[model samples]
Target chain A: MESSEAGLRPPRHRVSPRARAYWAVRASAGWLMPVAAQVIWLAADTARLGPHVAGLVLTAVVAAAHVTVMPQWRYRVHRWEATPEAVYTQSGWFNQERRIAPVSRIQTVDSERGPLEQVFRLANVTVTTASAAGPLKIHGLDRDTAQRLVDELTEGTSADRSDAT
Target chain B: MTERTEWRRLSGRMLVIHPIQELLRAWPVLIGLVFAGTAGGQSSWWSLGGAIAVIAAGMLRWFTTTYRVSAEQVQVRRGLLRRRLLTVPRDRIRTVDVTANLLHRSLGLAKVEVGTGRTDRKDDAVKLDALHVDEATRLRAELLHRTPARRETAREETATPSEVLLAAVPAAWVRYGPFTLTGLVTVGVIAGVAGRAVNEAHLDPGRLGPVSTLLERWEHAGLPAEIAALVAVLVVAVAIASTLGYVLAFYGFRLTRNTLGTLHVTRGLITTRSITIEERRLHGVEISEPLLLRAVRGARCLAITTGLRVGRGAERGGSLLLPPAPRAEAVRVGALVLGPTTPLTAPLTGHGRRAARRRYTRAVGLAALVVAALLVLSWTAGSPAWIWRLSLVLLPVAAFLAWDRARSLGHALIEATLVSRRGTLVRRRSALACEGVIGWNLRRSFFQRRAGLATLVATTAAGRQRIDVQDVPLGEALRLADEALPGLLTPFLDSADS
Candidate 1:
């Protein structure tokens, strides 16, 4: 929390509270693949494979730890703010990053909702510039908030006539 | 030139040239087909039929492809059944490359490639396969917004703006070639092809030149002697190959600033390549010296231009302002290309001891992790004890590299240029015009944050498109960003008291 306030403060606002549940479910869904592989290994139970119960146990421990810890960490780390001049975002839990793209250089602004996100009444907003360093993505926003953000970003970018590059 | 709306098919010369080119390409296959026909005692008619099919495919391309250069855009329509149309706006055209092989030259024809800086799709470029020399020159000149400038290579040796020469690599510069491993790569490619050919033909590789002698002697030679001989052979082979590659690619290299303002690069031996880069599209210059090249005091200079692809295999092809030459020469050419103020020679501000400590930690930590893994493997698998012992050598090397890498970490702002230098193995110093930077990224891993360091990246649309000054103190990173573009970061920062 202190580092989030370090030098440059964290962005002005957080995403929708429901994003916690969405991320928890998403993290669990990702953990399923490794869990499924371990389950299959345990079920197959080949003696020659040698004491493979360790694999299942290790996977369960890591998967449980990841699914429980990651969602809260991400929600705490992710923050975003947009103004007439620039868009700023702080993302990632362990490897944190802050990106600043001037409105004059913004090439496109897009908003979309996946099937799960729609069920959760959530959406994602992406603002990109011509540079290949890539887009700024803010996920787990309320659908209305995302739509408003997209519109506001569109308005800000269109008002600036400079070349994106 | 008046506005022209009509679609023009490729030069009629392709109809004649295509069949011969196709026949040449398919000769080995055709020969196999003939042999198979003879062995099977089938009619020889199918061989001629197969050859005709190859020629037909080639000739079909000539018939199907048509293009038109309008006032607003250049459009190309091609394909028999697919009917694909590629259109690029004239104003978006960044560079024009004209190429001609010996055959094309004999026929007085050239291939024109129009680049629009679009990386959205492969082969989006509009290429006219065979155009008459004069027409290609006129089109290249027009596309670049100029009358064809006189070139050492344009017959129209073709298309350069009337220009002032910037720098030309002399033939003696080829002495620097052996230091870089470009020739080894060429030899690798050649060896791969030769290996495939030998496999397919079931031929003996030993019969080729001195290879048989080496193979015969290898049975009698001791291990150390054999290694020494092998090393000597490899050294000679690589040096010879790279020298040949240097001569082939940069034989008549000339960089010129044309009257129309674009930079003109004309070079090649058997197959000539002329590339024109728009002046405004150029963001900066990068001077690179790989470790071996550094030992030899050799370096290469490249343009950080928006449209051209550089680095990897593309490094030798386009955006290269200077080939492997003396380090001083590289900087001189870098200054010449960047113009006026020479940020290329500016002294960079080094990150303090903390950044150096971080580099050592990361590098030594990585080496320790590798040793631990090897230990685990050796214990479980009962591998040779010497393996992990041998791995111990990497620890000292890693520490030395960490020291060098830390030494390389520095960034500075000189006049209007943002200079950043990094990398121990391939030390790259780039001087970017601050205006080319479109955005900024300040990143920190948990360890980096704990260490109070940030990797500040300037995201641009040119060259690699992102340049990083890694492991500077977070405060220094913020200050650099603000200084590079004074008010750009000020709006987003919250009271910069570090």
Candidate 2:
């Protein structure tokens, strides 16, 4: 109610310790896919080039690079702000591209948590606008922070649909 | 008020007959196969008997199937051996489209197509067949949000009279000129022959060789006379094809809006189709006059409806709100159908306008090159030579470009609404509301930049779809966006940025 009176943006950035635990759980959970694929292929033909060690290593390396690089990328990207009139997202590596869509234009907003993220109490927020272009998704947020942001944006935009469903 | 309306579920016996319906639907394929088999001398008496049995089984299945409806919902259980039941919730239905073929009209039956926007995929919309005319109307009325009405016995026998808001008999002043069905057929024949000749060059290289070899072997062969005969044939073919094409394109084009406010268009011959557009899904209505249509004081109008039927051809995608009507009549019809749209002002002159002219010239140049290529190919091949006639096609393109520029020439920005009309031949006008617009994008491609023109795309909440007006003056586009944005969100644009 207070946030509504202030017209959004009452909460400052809250560091999420739960968000980090979520990343670790997600990284390990994803290992299941490659493990399953390898088991299926190995059972089919025992002598067929054995297990693809190179592919496993490459995937791990890329994933590790992503995990290590994401925080620095996140730090560079400034905080998001959802006002009564618009939802502003400022993101970039260097040049800084700022996207501001009118709050009314925000058709849908989804907050989802994978099994690992659920374990670590982290959630991903996606803001969808009416066009073919992809939604604006921000991951690696603390559970409470994610919830609050969702509540704030949802209330601020006066969206007809609710996240309770 | 007197009619006591009621509905009952379609009979279970009907589903038992479904296999027959499936077989009947495949009758075209079966008939084609039979003709092909008989032509190849493969038909036996047993085969003939088998075909007759299959057709008889299908007819038996169709005759037994029937349905009843109620005020609340429509339930259909149809099939012969295996009955399948389908229950449709009346409230979920978005639009009910009615289609009547000659067979249906004579039989007093109509097909009802119900669109439920609940599906993520639009094509999965439900279509029910062979509803008795009264049943179809009752279903359509029920689908719409309205008070339930009791149907009387007398009302059941009479066909529902649909309210008509717009009508245009094809104008007398409009001449087909070279754009006719006959002309199309003639051109098609010549082109088909030429294409076959060219194909033969690749398919059978030995068929056509040096002229000297032909002359030496066949001294009686009048090569020049043969060539002249081909030319004469091509000229006649093109003329006839053009006439035929024009007739087919403009035949029985009627667009009507029902009192319920749904737009319906019925057109085409041989395989006719009817498309109904729900009022809520419509973005706006556009009225346009192409240079050719303009000369006859006629204009074409279209409605920007959601869920465009892709790969369905021109008639299927957007709602043709009006067949070519007199310019004044088109405006009036558009106003009635679309709810009073703003009129387009005459185009203004400046750097951007000059650039638009240059862009049109570029289009003309590209078409001229294509025409020239076709002419040269015809001359090289033993096909009919008609290069001069081909050059005349470029004239229309030039005229079309100038006229399109003249029409799309201005943009009107009224408070919270923006209306833009653009086109030379097939004109499109789009009216987008400020509240519905999700975002505004100003884009300038290399071509646009060179032409001092820019395009403004207004994205709306209905979809990521945009209303794009190309080759408009850059300053005007920006000014209109600025003005429109303020009305939608108040001074919130600045506060949101802050």
Candidate 3:
């Protein structure tokens, strides 16, 4: 772990290793939607394109690329750190974005574990503020880690609120 | 304080004025029905019955509504069957505005609207449709001044008279009207009215006698000449309408600041308006200069105050501390509104050459994308190649704009205030108190990272919520956050040795 003195640029922390499997499941679900539509079109006689072989091939290639390549790339790019002062998140691949939410500004911290995430023991933490830019989402953390982060954030914010007024 | 339990009705004049206003609103529908009935050869009795029903409903509504003001809250009870008792706490009240249209003014009545900070709910405001002018003014003062005894004591201690900040004369309208987009807005309004009139008339050009003859005369003149004439007429009409609108809206405009820490703005020629905003609630000031207004060295000043959640239209009409005036005058008023020591015209620190390059790249890329889209469209539609060739001229213009935008982006930390200036077409300079900043947001995209730049947004509870200093160096952004609010970011700073 990097020293805490890094200020707003906290040391990069990766999500749980099972995040790759979780992403694969999500990617397959997304790919199946278009593949299913293409299958319906191929079976339907009234389809305008009339069973496009090129389109089918392109779709398969795109889906295969997403399932195989995207998860690893995402894992490399996704980094988050929760300190006493702020929550830092660095995400995205092509247009990588780093965001910092000061602890004092945080209104609520919520941890949600979905059914798919339950299998992998993963959870996502959302930090909400009054900002119009919407909530700050920290995805793919271990369930226990997410819970501890939430508790830490809540405690920090509550301490700030008493002194702020 | 004596316990008052009686629920008082609005001024009796509302019974007459409300029904008349309701009838006026139904005029369009009544006219449409009349036309429809005449065309179908139906009786006029149906239209007459509809008018009576509308008037009866209006009267019933006026009779049923009643309001009461207690020490703790103001309650308005309305509706006979489905009664709604809206209770607004006395302390929660933020603004009190009184407005009077021609009819209301003639009847010595004004509409009093009490507003709280909550804007998400439509019914959060308490509106008394009609009240005696004197009573409205008194109520406005009472609601705005929460503690009357304290205000009186404070006023007596200061003993300072109200100072006039700005008063618009007829000549000021002529000087500022053309600089604003009011002419464009007037043109849009004229077009809408004309379109609606044409639809209602349904005049067939082929069967029309006078209109066809005029069309023939126009045809005798070439189509090009006819189009030119139409365009010239529209321009003249819009200019005249805009000037008239400016004169009508701000003929008797006045802005005054009192010792009681309240600002009173009274304006309008036909429909008079009185808006009161407390100085304590004011967060800061913003000086805005649109592209056209900037050309004329004109600017407008607005107050960034909390708990003044007037609707968009009302905000434009009321929140203006300084209307389209000289840049110097706007700055002067802005400084005055902010307080004695805070100067808005201080030199701001410019973001560096890397920011300029980033802006230029983004601007040129966007222009190129547009040109490419045009070329593709022309190729697919079999249009002339010159269509896209003409768009290639946008590159130089885009470069100039990007350079201008980069130069304009600046931020300054002046004592306890943070001033940020941005925008190419509508330049805005906002000065916010550092104490008001509740949080800080730091963002850096991939391009920004390569350029060593990031955007620092200061989140506050006042106007716009977030004020961003875009494309500043990453280190500078971190330094700004730390300086603006100490101890908040220091804990996370990396050790120097790292």
* Model 1 interface CAPRI class: medium
Best-to-worst TM-score order = 1, 3, 2
* Candidate 3 all-Cα RMSD: 4.3
Q: Local error of candidate 3 at B55, Å?
A: 4.7
Cα RMSD to native, each candidate? Answer: 4.3, 11.1, 4.3
Model 3 preserves the real interface contacts to a fraction of 0.41
Scoring only the A-chain of each prediction against the true A-chain gives TM-scores of 0.88, 0.55, 0.83
User: Considering every candidate listed, which one attains the maximal DockQ?
Assistant: 1
Name the runs in model 1 displaced over 4 angstroms: A1-5, A46-54, B1-3, B23-54, B146-161, B206-210, B312-316, B496-498
| Clashing residue pairs in candidate 3 (N, C-alpha, C atoms within 3 angstroms) | A5-B493, A5-B494, A6-B493, A6-B494, A7-B492, A7-B493, A7-B494
Question: Which run of 10 residues does model 2 chain B get worst, by summed lDDT?
Answer: B309-318
Superposed model 3: Cα runs more than 4 Å off? A1-7, A11-28, A45-51, A64-135, A139-165, B3-8, B41-57, B77-85, B148-170, B204-214, B217-231, B309-317, B340-343, B496-498
Q: Rank the candidates by lDDT, best first.
A: 1, 3, 2
Winner of 2 and 3 under TM-score: 3
Model 2 B-chain TM: 0.61
Write down the TM-score for model 2.
0.57
Instruction: State the displacement of the C-alpha of residue B331, model 3, in Å, after optimal TM-score superposition.
Output: 0.9
Residue B147 displacement (Å), model 1 = 12
Estimate TM-scores for all models.
0.91, 0.57, 0.85
